[model samples]
Target: MSPSMPDTPTPPLALSPPDLRPWRDGGSGVDHVHVRDSGRPGPTVMLQALTHGNELCGAIALDWLLRQQVRPLRGRLVLAFANMAAFERFDPNSPYASRCVDEDLNRVWDDAVLHGPRDSVELRRARALRPFIDAADVLLDLHSMQEAGAPPLAICGMTDKSLPLARALGQPATMLVDTGHAAGLRLIDRGGFADSASPRQALLIECGAHWEAISAELAIDVSLRFLRHLGVVDADWAESHLRCPLPERQRLLRVGEGIAARSQAFRFVMPTHHLMVIPRAGTLLAEDDGHRFFTPHDDCVLVMPSRRAGEAGQTMVRLGRYED
Candidate 1:
């Protein structure tokens, strides 16, 4: 049942947060433009959501924030929901349905691609909002994994600038992956995902899997914690948002084959949902017809399945309780 299921006491939708509606800005396909003291002139914090069009978990929290009274104690708070095309195309009980219309929105942070005349609808949206991201003091881009077992984690992407902030989010186990923060290959990695974004920085928090009720709530919780981090909100809420993080050091298991292999052989493996653990020297996924075998050489948390259906290599993230 959905969290909004009729039976769950629907926590009296409070009018405490801000409200966004028409959800369309003059048919430009810009879903609701909500501003809470935008010009109050303090450090600007941008929380961009639903960039993928399919991930609507943030939408609920966005709605809650809209309905609630957000009194940012410090800098200004700006909330934006992308992909109006997908939002309009939504079907009930299937929020995280469309990843993108043509290409992934989160993968286009590069201004050149964003501004290029050849950009697709997704890229166009990315371009339209460049100024906001460029000027913000901080950016908390919320996202959820597709698999089931992968614990909620924050991606630092090896950016020296974003490392400390990642650590601060309190996920405990932080992985320092190598990727550029500017190319926009992924929504969060570019410029080494380590840029010293002076007066600004970004953190990508994987709340939960697709359509998971807690995903939206955790998105909201993290946003509140971010405000606290910026000194824009009270410390109490931040404290509440903090989760007992995992460990300092972690191991990133490699997905040698990628998604193509999984599609043909793996069965019943959900990558975006974050599930399955491939024990070292253990059978990760047995190929149908018994022609091939998938196994892990080291003990690790199998992250995202590289293969579409293959239950082998992919999002395999093994965390350590101790720092190596």
Candidate 2:
């Protein structure tokens, strides 16, 4: 835990609603903004939706949070509908309409690309949202996975500033891995570096079931809880939203493979619902062609599998702490 919070509130903060925008996500046609209760001055928290495009729960959850008049235990808030284009393009009746139109928007968070020529819609939007990201002190890039029983998890890197949140949201699990900042894949994780210099806490909640309501509710509850715990909202309101107490200790799983990949034989993996103990050395993979498979250590509960199984990809993960 970093030495930033006190056992009690010294100076209360205020928060407004999250601001939304469509100008940044390119021209796929989905654009949105949500601003709430901004009269109070507090820390700036930005909640965004549709990072994966198909993850619908977060979008609804954002709508719920935006519609409320939240009393900040103390800061400002900014909410955005990240992918209005993809949201509009996909029909609820069609499950596989299109997770993305041109490219994966979640993977395209870079400032320099704003002026560069873009070959795809993903690049255009990434360039547009640079400023909102730059202004935020904390970002909860909400997402959902195609896994069963995800149990709601929060992932933060080695940033000490935001680690408190990981500890507080200790539900499914937490991991502190090197996100390959040079690759420009994880913008919020890498972009937040300027605020704390050393690692600052960032949240990537994998709620569960791409379109399930449970995932969305958990994401929203935990987010509001975060605001409360950190003085962003009234502690009472946040406390009312608590589903799970903070876990004393959480585990971090290393990516045995890249997060975005296909398992030729597996569609997805539910790590939290397993009973077998995982071994430390190899990976637990959906191998179809006789490659090898392994998991973490002797007693670890794994969650969130990249299910797009097929071919050997970098998305398979191994669990570990930053120092380990």
Candidate 3:
């Protein structure tokens, strides 16, 4: 069992869980796969939500898109609500418990992991969804953070192709380049999306805190921009629904390494949030069991500090640096 850490109050659930019943029997021959084809030649763009069941912002955005009758003007548009089994278990009082049913859906995208004989609720879903994902020319996977007050982020793989796609979305202020977790590959990093030479591109957006009302709005804004950028929807239609101005500029952060919990006693020296930069090298970040972890370099940025203290071998936070 995980040791108990400090008791922090759970944030009020500002957004209601989306009723995904209407999308369950999607026309794409797969559950939750809503595909719209313009019959014109263009790239097939996919927008996926609910990668993590606890993250409701993306689900809300996808719900709104359906209500608004949003469609494609070019090739094809796929709006997918993933991890339904996990999502169905979401409870306002215990929101975090529903992040997954058996395993994280986002982490089972590797070819080896997907093709392996291993069976789980999430892996089964991933296998079923892999065909649609493999057919997509571009994918935008929506997500949200664990910590409150953390700004929105565009998580891209370490490739030039995806960086520009994140920049093109232009709502989120920070674009983080990463190789993904050591435990497994993410949906965005699967197949051609991981290849720098491949024209296929994917970007994962961390809209904001999991249940915040504003996170839903941010998801809608970015989703609209993604559609507009791909010509799936016209600029007028997308811009009309935008509730806020776009960021003047976006900053890029290159993740250097993740600080994994070395033991069950891991604890941060201080409270941390995403994009918090430590000013000097060797600054104490955390202590785990008998070991101490310090910043390796000056101006080290911490990404997504874990709320679950003492979760052995799990990533506590990622350390990164700004890119010029």
Candidate 4:
């Protein structure tokens, strides 16, 4: 498990991890991948879950959809459960241990990594799922945060098409326009999804806290909305399943920079909340090694501040500003 604050005890596992054994031998020839085709000609929409095994909301959401036998009304719909090997090892007593077996599955999406000789559990899986991801016209990768009570965020990667799609979803309320992490490429930013000229777009939603019951609810609601938005699922059926009310409007936050930890001693001056806006410029935020981080501009927003004691080069927090 990653090193979290010593003062804070581990939160209770509020949501049970779903039994995913039935989905092992999925329809797509790839394990845990199910594809439904309308055979009518439309965009292929893919909903992916369990990129991180600890983030159970997405897995619960995908399992619920599969159980409901949700099919596309127009084109193909792909429901994939990624990092199942890691997920299979999940124990409620120590939920954080199974995020990945070797490395984060979400980080090995770069072409060089996938095509390289270096082999790992996550890389193999990413390679296996690459074809389906390539074929998708729209992709929604569901995830959850480490910190509790943080608001849901749509991670719209650096692409013109992504922000517009997030605006269309309208629920999550807050959208973040960010480049993929420095460590590696995220699944959402891979291939055509990140290409401005390509019609394909992908979004990664941070639903809420990993084990929160409400996170699962939000995940399902977002999935329904995403499917409905893509015209893959019937509007009435999707609407019936949506439990959350639409936000009054969506706000966009453009990430200016991600503060990566330079040492194991990295820490914030105080507890920081997600989407917390600091009114003044040059306010103290965090310190790593000998370097200190401060607000670069007035009305600076803190996005996804890490509660854990970060490893060297891990993103401790991202600094952003509201666009609207």
Per-residue lDDT tens digits for candidate 2, residues 1-324, read 001112322221111222333233323233454444456676667777777666766776676665565544445666777666666675545433446667667556654554566667666666656666676677777876554454555556434455566666555555444343333456555566434664344677766556555676676776776676566776776677666455566765443223333345533333333222355545454343444444534543343434344354534333332232
- Alpha-carbon local distance difference test for all models: 0.54, 0.54, 0.86, 0.87
> Where does candidate 2 stray beyond 4 Å?
1-31, 36-41, 71-74, 112-115, 158-161, 170-184, 194-200, 241-249, 254-277, 280-303, 306-324
Model 1, span 1-324: residue lDDT tens: 011112222222111212235444523234454445535557877777776555556766666665555667656777778766665665544443455677667767665666666758777777766656666667777766554434555655544566667656554253433443232466555332335555357777676665566566677776766677677767886576544433555433222322223233545333323435445564544454355444545443444443233233332232222123
Q: After superposition, how far is residue 219 of candidate 3 from its true place, in Å?
A: 0.5
Q: Count the backbone clashes (under 3 Å) in each candidate.
A: 53, 50, 0, 0
Q: For candidate 4, lDDT tens digit of each residue in 284-314?
A: 9888778998889999998888765546877
Q: Return whichever of 3 and 4 wins on lDDT.
A: 4
| Evaluation by lDDT, superior candidate among 2 and 4 | 4
Sort all candidates by lDDT, best to worst. 4, 3, 2, 1
lDDT per residue (tens digit) for residues 1-324 in model 3: 011123546689899898999878769898998989899999999999998888899999999999998879999999899998889999887887888888888889999999999999999899988998999999999998877767889988766679888888877989989767777898988989998779999999999888888899999999999999998898998989997577889999988778888776888888777788999999999998889999999999988887666457878888999986
* TM-scores of all candidate predictions against the true structure: 0.70, 0.71, 0.96, 0.96
Q: Cα deviation of 170 in candidate 2 (Å)?
A: 4.4
Query: Which run of 10 residues does model 1 get worst, by summed lDDT?
Result: 1-10
Evaluate model 4: give its lDDT.
Answer: 0.87
